[model samples]
Target: MSCQEPEFVTAEDVGGFDDLWSSYGFYNEGCFEKGAPLVLNDQQLFSDFAFMDDMHFDSISSAISVAAETDQPASNSELLQLDEKSTPPLPSKTSELLSKYQFKFNARSGEKPNESIERGGSKLSTEDFMRIAASFFIQLSTHKDCNPFMLNNQFGLSFSGLSSAEIMNVELAILLFSAAEKVSQQRFDHGTNLIKECYKLCSKTGNSVQRVVYYFADALQERIHGGKGTVVKAQEVMKALLSNHPVHLATFRSLPLEQIMQFTSVQTILDNLGSAKKIHLIDLSIKHGLQWTILMQALSNSSSVDYVKISAVGTSEEEITSTGKRLTSFAEILKLPFVFKPVIVSDIKELKEDMFKIEETETIALYSSMDMNTMIIKPDRLENVMKVIRNLRPQIVTVVDVEAKHNSRSFINRFTEALFYFSAFFDCLENCMRGDERVRMIVEEDFFSPGISSIVAAEGSERVIRQVGIDVWRLFFARYGLVEAELNQWSVYQASLLVKHFACGESYSFEVNGKALLVGWKGTPLHFISAWKFQ
Candidate 1:
């Protein structure tokens, strides 16, 4: 919640991207300091207990026992009865429960569950299991007075009647919780054992729940064993992913979320530039530069536009060069005079105004998508990046990022938030991809899995996937003398139309939060795109 001015370190002080990746334990300094733990009084505890009356507890107990003992899957009628008796608490009630129990639940409003569980035949859906298991684990993990391993004896809970899949997921959640607890307590050996057990039940190739649990377990294992090798391997995966244009393009096409971001960002840039004849774009993390193609095509139609230049900032020279070639080729086909400048940098904080070679006459616009969050671990670096942008005096800056609160200092809080956030995301993928397992797996494993690992496994500065909501970003940007540039109504309409073009796109919804545009699945806001200009 506060920012501490740390001594700035130059690129030479920190070796390169490899060194930055290898180094962990960089605290956020004063920013996002862990707040004092909430203490629950006896009266508050009684009130919370009153909310879960005897009928609810009895129904939950009966359901657990029935699910554990029965060989056949529970019928919809039976499940519905149980669900009615012991329904998952609503978001407000859930927060109260977590608070009373001395746990934190800061999941976004978009992550709230629907009024009713979406029944899929006799068996519970993966998402349903995730919700149940997450709640169950919360109770088990926070009960410091009782031993979680002896839940049957200590809490009178049974795992007998549930389906095999349900049992597997619940067991994995328990193991993961136990392992995380051990890691936090610095009991590496015990945590490692629990992690191994988690691996036994988890599968990256299994259902969405299993895939996510598998990655969480992997992260815990890495956390226990000093994750240098894991970091190196992740870097390799990212490098390969960035260099592969076809895969990137396919991902961009398959996922409407990316297109929503890219389209909205491009539209915002075009709208803000007016009739500028010469425009320069500075992309902070221009992986494959696919977004610019849309901008170039838009500009090609404008008679007043004379020249377009894109100064792409990235880590890999080869990848940037490759992206330049593609964008250059696309520009030629459109008959637009274009230049692609690859502004390669070892670290984003190393970015300087001189590297961009800006002109006095050219109108400047900056774009960032899922990039700024990485710089968050180091506040000074993030500040420096912001300073660079502010100094550039861009006409407009567009930013699109995943919308979630995953920057908590508390592991369990962050873990819970991530569980819900990714649960919604995975559900979105399942609905959108439908039968295309291959593409879904590629997107999940290649693009998202690394982020999950970083969030769960790494700690301090090493934990790089520190995504926050727009409210936090608004405050951060405001400190750097940037103000929100309202996105026009047409951009919102265009984004909605783009969503309709996809098969399951109707599930995706948009909202204009102040000047920003939020695209969410169902009711959950997964991403937000907003424009900014210097104050």
Candidate 2:
């Protein structure tokens, strides 16, 4: 929740593009940071418009297709060519590996959504709105596979049913804030006017709803103003919202679009283990531990894994305890000697070699699915963290990170990249969650909305939303002397299996760059999972 200011020495990169790390957006402070007004004089010369790979996005993962060979830096010609045509329909195959473990999603809407905000929502009977809200929360918060747009039509419908325009304003505020990913300017403009009306109507300056509304207004406004977000305000509102509606945070579990890849990466590390006695799975950011359950089942099925132990680290002690107990119960059921060691840390930085109590003889595998890299604030921090990890000498360090370059100190470049990345993402969501507006609302409110705001608004260490390509991580690992272990064929196949089984019509492509497996929708790299070993 708090940011760690990782200090780095200013080492200049004079010959920018030719250097390996240049395209990856890992440069010294002097080379990248624009003091106040975004000045990227040096970076501008080396800059190329970064966009998707040879990606043609469709409705679901089935329709989406990727050309794995196209990892080239983007060009104007390519962009122009891409602009002219619709997403090229690419073919995908359903492998046998998908049948055993597949994450599925289908957008189901009871009634079709309306055309626009111009035509106001249909009126509902008195007190029916509460039932609707309850239904929305249950179906969305509970089910991982629910379509995001499940309640899309309810936005205007809910507004129409409210007794006072004041409550309607509040509802509009929530919808507009959540729908930033795929709403038109006209709808956004109408929501803006409603927000202004709420300010005029409601007297409570400290009201929680008012605060959330204003905070989202600021966040959405900042994105419109070239993606410079109101970070402090956004975080404050986010903290407040989490305090009031705790379940909002758990919305991620319902939609396990990428969990299959994460588990595969963990299983791959587990598979690589030799004849070690106690195999320790060190999960840096273990949330709910459901992903671990999948790996545990795999381990239980096999007679090989004798004593499987885990060190589950998380920000929430309650979550850790519950996950630990859950795993222990499963292990008891399986009758395997499994030890669940749950560690509570305020920050992931607290996760160092000293925190781990593994015996010298035990084999350890570090599993970080979409979190460990964010702990790295700067190059110096990475080096320091790498030292700790290096000391631990984990047999394999599995990492998964977003592909878009969000690390650029320069605002303009960072904003542009984020916009491009999210646009494709929104389009993908639209295709996948087309009819399910209700599910779309939850996904946007809990996940994508915050991501957009955080990336666009926050600066420096506060901008933990930063993501980079695999090459950058390749450099960091290589620099720290951690040997890159290419994700195995089985791991890659597992990833492809998820896409094959669950992608609906969306196509997902997996490519290997050196020692990393890059998984992207259409052609743009969404997530990259890699493995490393200590030299």
Candidate 3:
């Protein structure tokens, strides 16, 4: 057929190689000279629909049809954003609540209160400190035994606990710096006014914290303006800011709650199966069993499947204990005879040998919510993981993780949800009053950085140190010729939506004013299937 001639293709078609080529350059360059509508081939009709219903895209089928009629395929990049217009309106209740908090706290003028938290007064009473300390100690003491499920329910550091004045000092400075960087239009000068104000309030001997803040704001301004000597300036500033600081890089070594949430997000995308066998969850870091606790609960409640065995892997022993305990408990609750094994390797070469120890079976479902993202960031680590999973060839590898896009570029609908929900949780903690109102104070004053609040509000856990979930899953499946599974479960859908929401914010805007496409802070739910059948 002539390039311009109408041709038939399956409506179920993801752009074919030819369409991809044309979409990239040829078609846009006038390769298709005809105005005639393409009679695209269609896939088998849905069982109930006699017509070729299965061939169609559900939400954006109309847009796709237009592209097809023009002898050009819709670009994948644009297709990803098609849903931008379809975001459901946010609930009025949610909007009002967020607005109230935003006005109350974000609008506050002058320096934030003496949140400097000194010991004395009923506001800073010993009883209050003891309560906070007790909760903090429990988390530290149970680090090896605490999983996300347990910790999530308790009052502990959602990301990292802040108790020592030294840790808090460094953390607060960083938070201010990051916040200043984000809000500043010039990237460098936005927080200068604030810093200068802080200086005036400082003690005469030159408070290092205030100095560090001033230096950081100066360095940030330099970096944004493309001024010379940015790196050296930043380094110097960092040295000064962190110098003599109590908490070292070692204190910030492990992943945060935000990271762990990515792994659990995979569960939200899973098909609510009534029954199944072994399930394999993969990830680079699995400390304190946070993600596993969530997974165990998901499995126990899954309507579609029942799991008898679970194979989980972590980068180290320190990350495995809590996950292991949670998994064991989950199995016990369900009264299912289960074996939870941790895949470990002292060396990369050993991983291959140890990986083979798991039985190759058809009934297994491989769930790697955290693995894929870490692999994307560190492809080398994924090579062995991909090979092992490919060999075992589990029924499904459901990936749940944070999308790699920065918060600014995330899908708007999910982003809104995330902003609203996260703000609610954060406000709950930050708005803690002194005395009986400690919780609000903790949220507001304790975790000031977007990073910390972000982790605590949504993703606080060990899940943060790995690769992006989507990229890792895509590559892993493609390497083994696996197909992207359909999401057939509601929980999986919720998980996806939750993640999308987590990444969004008020800065997001749609093409129109009132029709704002607020982020839902959730994502599309998915169900996965295998191209090849299990044994």
Candidate 4:
């Protein structure tokens, strides 16, 4: 096919790749100027879908409103505009309620109320103080083997001081954590009891916290019954795949996580490729070939890109073929010289270098997102895969995976890590999809629930959700003679800008550790994206 002339358009005119960022005012003449501090339009910082409607935020606001009415009536404006620097004492009722829950209020000199609450110090607005107390309750339950009944008593100490929503948060946290603790101890009966109580306290259609807790409770119940509770027939799996595929795609469009990784990977590949005319991408998990659409668009805009080929690797031949066809169609639309090659393998470990059919002229880049971690369950298979990758001599290998340490041998340790990790993730989803509960639940149930089940319910090799931190990944890559490649500042800045455009963006942060970019939520690392080149 003859390629069309490259079209030059402004960032605002570009869709697909640039739509999310540019619409939020991330693109301008001096937006990406080197050494310039990344600044976002304050007005565009919070989207309509942002987390201002968070259940905890609302509950806290309600509780504070009640406190204000009793102590000294304060207007809604006064409540919101409270001085962050001042350490205003909480109402006597709120203080007693916190004290009963074993949460102390120690306001530090000149510290923000939120920061103080995070550090176990407080003189927070009644809202922030209650939110912190709920978090403390979860932490205390998870980290310590406290009696659930006692915790429940503490929660019941002064419901008059709390709104109905606040009471539900307390009840759900205690029940969910208590149930998780029992499951970890192998006390299946006890776990079942607490999970039942959790079910009664929360609903799948309820608030964000309720929905997340409900799912976790379901996973705990499955754990008690041993491994999914029943065998999943192939027909059932296929049926689920068919039903959930649309929701999955919608999630990709709605959430920034997947796009952030893909954008970074594509940028890394383009940076390394320079003016190479022949490009080959070996996708470890091609799925729907969504990431490559961005690459193809960029390549179509570049005169240097003469030929493009993708060897999509996946387990299902049908799915891979479908992805190849879709990409081929997209490539034709761009009038780009493109070839879609499907490399089907029964298992990722079965991958052979010859399967890729690499040509000497082709500049190759390998992209793996949440795929290699599955192979870690069998070290030999993973090492063999790495060996094949090393021998292929790809110009750059991009990796994006969960930044959690869930590969621990101890069940309790792994459970604790997974609980906190998924909690943050679900909380993030709640913020990102505040008004759109249906899509949010679909993503949670279809995409996230299985991973949670595998981590909590399965054992040994059956547990395929083995995610490790970047530190572990660095060590593993080093053993394979791969050196980390530094991600450019432009990519990091774009990622930061992308995150700040969402609700609760202040809670989301980006940190650079050596050669990797870590995406964190509320100070806890959730995922990392990095690039590596063979030494």
Residue 368 lDDT (model 4): 88
Q: Pick the candidate with the highest lDDT.
A: 1
Supply the global lDDT for candidate 4: 0.61
Against the hidden true structure, what lDDT does model 1 obtain?
A: 0.63
Candidate 2 lDDT over residue span 1-535, tens digit each:
0011112201110001212122223233332221111112333422322321212211112111111122332222332232111221211111111111111101223322321121112222111222233223222322333332323333334333223433343343323322332112323443344334334432223332333334445455554454454455445443333222344334333323466466668667767776666788888666656667776776776666668889986667776777789889988898777988877666544557767788777889888766644544433434445566767878988887776666555444554455446544544454455555566555555555676677655655566455666665554454345668867677666656655555332345566667677666546567777888865
Count of clashes, each model: 12, 27, 77, 1
In the range 1-535, model 3's lDDT, one tens digit per residue, is: 0111112211121111232112112122223222212221222101112111111223334334544554444443322321322332322221232233334433446525333333221122212222232223222222333221222133222312222342333333323322242323332343344334334433212233433333333433333444344333323332322132222222212212233233434443344232445454444334444455555665666545434555555445544555677668767987655666677665332466355355554255555433343332233444556556555665555544443221221112112223233333332222221232333332223222222222211211211221121322342234344546544444433434543342222212212111111112112211121112122
> What TM-score does each of the candidates earn?
0.70, 0.57, 0.39, 0.69
TM-score, cand. 1 vs. native: 0.70
Q: Is candidate 1 or candidate 3 better by TM-score?
A: 1
The total number of steric clashes, by the backbone 3 Å criterion, in model 3 comes to 77
Query: Each candidate: what lDDT?
Result: 0.63, 0.49, 0.33, 0.61
**Residues 424-500 of candidate 4: C-alpha lDDT, one tens digit per residue:** 77767776777778898776776677777776676655565667667656645654567899776687788778877
- Model 2 worst lDDT run, 10 consecutive residues: 9-18
